[model samples]
Target: MAKTFASTGDTAEKTITFAEIGEGLYAFTAEGDPNTGVIVGDDSVMVIDAQATPVMARKVIERVRTVTDKPIRYVVLSHYHAVRVLGASAYGADEILASEATRSLIVERGKEDWESELGRFPRLFQAAESVPGLTWPTMTFPTRMTVWLGKRRVDLIHLGRGHTAGDTVAWVPDSRVMFSGDLVEYHSACYCGDAHFADWPKTLDTLAAYNPRALVPGRGDALDSPKMVADGIALTRDFLTTLYDSVSESAARGLTLKQAFDRSREVMDPKFSKFAIYEHCQPFNVARAYDEARGLDHPRIWTAERDREMWEALQG
Candidate 1:
């Protein structure tokens, strides 16, 4: 292969920032890395999207400690990605919540995803051995679940499929603030390896209807205004659509997977080359896009072996 598989060479640590976006809502962002959301209610706190590992989650805990001593009573898993859900134990919350589909995905592919992601992006899994095992949600809901942190209310809703089949958002209706887990990204490449390219845009529409005043994205800096929120949603939509459109066009011409990958990159690189994870995501994104364009609706599970085979086929 001409290059390493996925983000193997991306070892530089990002600068973490904790910014207050609402009354007591904060976005814990690390440059373009996955972000964590904090909502402080009257007497307790709720965390959204735990980091890749317990050691990594400790950093977010440190920041949360600076602002409030209220126990983190809830930990919400936005989806079933290992990098996002494996750190639930760090919170030691009363209960961990996730969508029913998310929980099922964990049962089906969680272990495989753990191995695949760790091999691809080692930097994100700091102290990976500290992870006791696959994180499980003690509580599961179907479409929407509401939790009251004293007077404050948080609604965890599954708008539709996007980044994954079980994508869910933490919505604060009263404050018009949302924690969109990988459903929206600002100036960062959308990782579509496990994504539904066709369903993602429609789901974004569901999120936009809320007219969010502030949003904590899965990656990049927080969106603190309605305009920024809209832009983030638009950017994510554009990335997914652009990628799918390009691959669809190539596939329609009966291009092979490698040929389709090259053609799609030519079209996408000019616009997205500089985005975070652009290089790491390109090969997998195109491979999945190629499958979807050819009428494969469900994305294939990606194990470590499949990851290597796909990388070599496209990047070699």
Candidate 2:
């Protein structure tokens, strides 16, 4: 697969690319960094996800201003992650929407996650001083909801918990375009530090059932056809499977987490070495996989302290 990864500030200004993926719909992706999507309708606009901080969000706003003057009526939280949801207030959105599980996760571990992420990815959280605090969604859904911006229909579906319990994918059926949050990443690393690996593939099946003609992945460029869409989903699935299998095998041999990280890296680096944040992700991915392989179903909360401990343990 062809790939390009731009590692920079939260905005990743030089690498940011916005493409008109569907009619009146746009995808703003920053190389292999986090991305934001826009759906402009006759009456209002909906932003798929806000960036890390208000300062970062301003870049998205500036881009939106270039295309439409309509008010941003809603900010959709694809999942409850610091990088995805913290800049919400900047949108001045009437409603910030999320799934019930995401809301619960926010209450359960949002603060620690905010601290942990801020400590680890200082670059992504640029303008960290501007974050008001952990962002909470004012509105939420249990399974599915279709909201209409005038006549355009955007279906928000909670297919199943994979990356996180409350992950949601925004699908625009008429246009055959889907904005798959972190649920889909084109050629980037999957931050499975908090993922449900066993359940993730099933969720991918649900996403594939839609057969989107075009997809705005969690990161990377927007895929423009069914062939590429299938390739993207398949690649993401392979990534999850490879990480999990390597750790499960390592743990079976009674190896340490660091050992598992080393083994996994040896196997995956040749293929995934160039993926964005590949270095930062390997240790954490192995730790989560080790936990899950030992029959731990849910990912343990990650605190700033835990982040440091894990990084130190596996910083090879």
Candidate 3:
């Protein structure tokens, strides 16, 4: 469908970089691919988001070993997306954590999402068979939960909905560093396939109030300074607002889905065409924005079958 969903051709290997943004805090970024945040405490370590497969996660583990030999006690699922959580088993952490909404999403659509994402982006899942099965969170929380690794404290908060209903961020009060899931993206297209477009900005505001000295985004380079952190948040906000405004206006003018897509593309391409996953995400983002602008508060679940249906309808 739509030629492997737009990004299957992107098989070029990305250069991986692991930067220590704060004391014992690292951001493992592979160009524009999904990023993994590492928080090492005095005695133990914590990982923010797992990669797509256990094989892929080993790369992060290899990097982790380079710095500290502390045992990884926790793996935090930023959200319920298969691309982010499926590699959890590789960590062998004592506990896996996620929001209650995330857990419910896993129960509801985890398998379908696994097939859907694996098909859409083959490059991310290096070894598909290596994924044992759907990753499940052993521990779940509602709004906010705090965990301590010796003296270091990590606060996991479900700020609000943005990338998905279960969006959660890890806040390290001591370092003022935030591990924002897909709630924010920097110089990359926000995959709005399951996004709450209207509610995203408000959540961004809540994130900004923290005034994080550094931010580890779900994708793109990690922001090491306060100004870069603010810039990242601003860029994410602009992308969402522009996408919704373009599609909402077209919808108001009685445009069909295709017509709305065309209008949205004309407005977004010039500014965001170079962003990571812009091509892969535009159609889905426009479709969701169109739906949300029409008063749909909750995003519709996306399955492998539905993904093909939407892609063929818009891209065919």
Residue-pair clashes per prediction, in order, are 0, 0, 0
Per-residue lDDT for 245-292 in model 1, tens only?
Answer: 999999999999999999988999999999989999999999999999
Number of the predicted model whose lDDT against the real structure is largest: 1
* Pick by lDDT: 1 or 2, better one: 1
Cα-based lDDT at residue 66, candidate 3 = 100
Best-to-worst order by lDDT is 1, 3, 2
TM-score for predicted model 3 compared with the true structure: 0.98
Ranking by TM-score: 1, 3, 2
Task: Look at candidate 2 and tell me the lDDT of residue 111.
Answer: 94
lDDT measured at residue 162 in model 2 versus the true structure, 0 to 100: 90
For model 1, give the 10-residue run with minimal summed lDDT. 1-10
Candidate with more favorable, higher lDDT: 1 or 3 = 1
Model 1 TM-score, all chains together: 0.99
Model 2, position 42, has a per-residue lDDT of 80
- lDDT, candidate 2, 30-110, per-residue tens: 878789999998899999989999999999999999999999999999999899999998999999999999999999999
- Residues 1-316 of candidate 3 have per-residue lDDT tens digits of 3456758889999999999999999999988899999999989999999999999999999999999999999999999998898899999999999999999989988988898898888999999899999998889999999999999999999999889999999999999999998888999999998899878999999999999999999999999999999999999999999999999999899899999998998999999999999999988888888998788887787777887788888888
How well does model 2 score by local distance difference test? 0.88
Q: How many backbone clashes can be found in candidate 2?
A: 0
